[model samples]
Target: MEKQTSANKPHIMTIPYPYQGHMNPMLQFSKRLASKGVQITILATNDVKTSKLAHTSSINIEYISYEIEQGDEIPKSVAAGLGYVNHKVLKRVPGIIEKHKASGSPIKVIVYDSLIHGALELAHKLGLRGASLFTQTCAVCSVYYHVQRGSLALPLEGHTVSLPSIPVLEIEDLPSLVQAHDRLYPGLLEVIKKQFVDLEKAEWIFFNVFDKLEEEIAKWLSSQWPIKTIGPSIPSMFLDKRLPDDRDYGLNLFKPDAEACIKWLSAKATGSVVYVSFGSVANLAQNHMDELAWGLLNSNINFLWVVRETEQNKLPGNFKAEASEKGLVVSWCPQLEVLAHKAVGSFMTHCGWNSTLEALSLGMPMLVMPQWADQTTNAKYVVDVWQTGVWVKARDKEIFTREDITNRIKDVMDGAKGEELRVNAIKWKEQAVEAMSEGGSSDKNIDEFISKVISTTT
Candidate 1:
């Protein structure tokens, strides 16, 4: 496709931390803006630019690539990688902005992922408006805001904490990065601390959530910043709420084993299969993997599991052969499609925001096993706020036993409690759909955001 050039139109640049979860929502947001005739330039790493899995068809959205130094040697930890990328991107912004200006579509504003705080400062230096696009929920953002304000203390693992206008949460339910003792904590904490500082400086803060979904929290947050809710940022195919031709989000980092997984799901009874995935980033310990395999096999449930190719060898020996009778394991499966299937009754997930929104949108109850970052908070919301799923708590704050996993899965997929969770899941699904539909909260917010961009740029 040819690049469209229109100097009069508002030109917005988006920079998402280079990951599937961060890229997906930011891409969707760009698509929504492009649909409204805005010129969008999405800055991505060289890896995403070359990967065949990353796809999008918005005519107004252009992708600019930058080389990540130490590309192959970048650490696997999200916190470490985030810091590295933020540093690289901060240096590249001036050059990128100059290239766009040379093309006569000078960037009028920047929409940056919350993790990359340096971008906001750069935007100010360039005389461009900067908006913080939080890919996580408002509750997590609020917690971070409080942390920056010194209203909340971190490393409260053994204590319960309460925040104004939010639910009471144990310190354990907070983002794991706040644990001062973890190896990545110091760097991650510094990133977050800087983020809060930049967030206060940003002109607007956008969340990938709708007002109705988290009304109280959103309202409370809006009181503090110029905030907008323009999301559920899911594929139009799944939600059927966006423009008619808009379908997939088109941001897949992994090739999906779609046909095989769908065929397996087709053979299962409705609400009978337990779908498990820990998302793209989180890694499981070897002992935890063994316990998970045993737990799933011993539970006597039909399951579809997505284990990454790199981690497949960690599974117990002969495990696939024995579990093949009732389970299907693939390197990756089309998650949105799988969750929307009638066969998928409950999900055993890492509670990433994207995964959580997908499950809620499809009315699929969850068995949340959050790993790190915003996941623990998402799990807390799932079990306590929404009542649509059960959380798997680590035994003695260190290990999660196979029995605990089995019991939690059963609790959400079998009895009276399971039925209630299912009903609640369906309720959330309906609410999500309504929020995305025409004239709904998310739709209105997007329209308003586009209007603001156009007005400010003009």
Candidate 2:
């Protein structure tokens, strides 16, 4: 496990926003690049010293630390309100760049998360090649590129957009925030226009979603920009090491009670339990949670819910009394393993690309409730393109009672329509296996992209 250092090795450095969502993908990319003989340096904000992700020490790459904190006056454009990609993440880059440039090992290229504007600029200022890392689907990334070209940008109001392929689906069939933040659509536009002082300086765009999975969007991305498709990077890296599928602290931040969840699942018959998780970011109001709880109850289905503490909207506590016995609730379970468990019939999800891809890979059908931008799109694909799931719209803040929530859950979980989703879900699962195996589309795309990376000259 010695550092592979030589003049000929490609000296590639990476910086990911300290959140698990950003860090996980960067680690996967670093691992893959290390496996391919690159001399890698992965820079973490000084906060990583306290974060659990810093525990993984790889000899192939050097860990350079940058400190991120509240004191550094950060711009509001990048503020996510919480987590690593906040203002603190951006303020650390100037120091990180200065340290890397002064160090004897000159950085040849930097791959950084798109949310971090300062680091990418500093890398360009140092005459280094820089790439933006996007963990979402390529369609979303292409939309960013389009927005940059002024193809889409309206006054920030309550306007809805009709994407090219989406059908005339109701809001209930889309995955989006109940409050409708239009987060990715608007926030990313601001990042391009205001946050990154140097937009044209980027060398490449790296996506963690593969090409075949996003055929039309990937094609559009490649036509306009130097784009690389290399994902469900998590699964590729998970199976990259000749190891069995399991959970690690790298992805699951909360202490996983996988055994507990799986044991409960084991007690149920096949396709009897519904696995519910709304992803890392999204949070529901207490009234919404009560309705959802009632819905699961009315459906009379065995359900496992990953309840986040943020859903305490003054009503969750009261609703809990009704749902106490009918559901198994844990803060977090090993998501991948739980989804693959024999009894997991369907998933209730936020439709984040990572979660959507994982559910798709596991052959689990979905009941999509999206909280942000691409999730809405992902939800549409789940129900429309794939024909393997149902999507729920965010209900009005006051009128959405428990009875309504219970009925929707019953529709997707216990009714005749739910059966159709299951049949198609199993079919998509077969395609996912084909895509992951040797000569599979995912494998082939990675090979093609890696070949381009190897053949390209600085």
- On lDDT, the leading prediction is 1
Cα lDDT tens digits, model 1, 197-226, are 846688878999877679999998888888
Q: Name the TM-score of candidate 1.
A: 0.91
Q: For model 2, where is the 10-residue window of minimal lDDT?
A: 237-246
* Candidate 1 Cα errors over 4 Å, as ranges: 1-8, 50-80, 155-158, 181-184, 393-397
- Using TM-score as the measure, which candidate wins? 1
Per-prediction TM-score: 0.91, 0.79
lDDT (Cα atoms) of all candidates against the true structure: 0.81, 0.63
In terms of lDDT, the poorest run of 10 residues in model 1 is 52-61
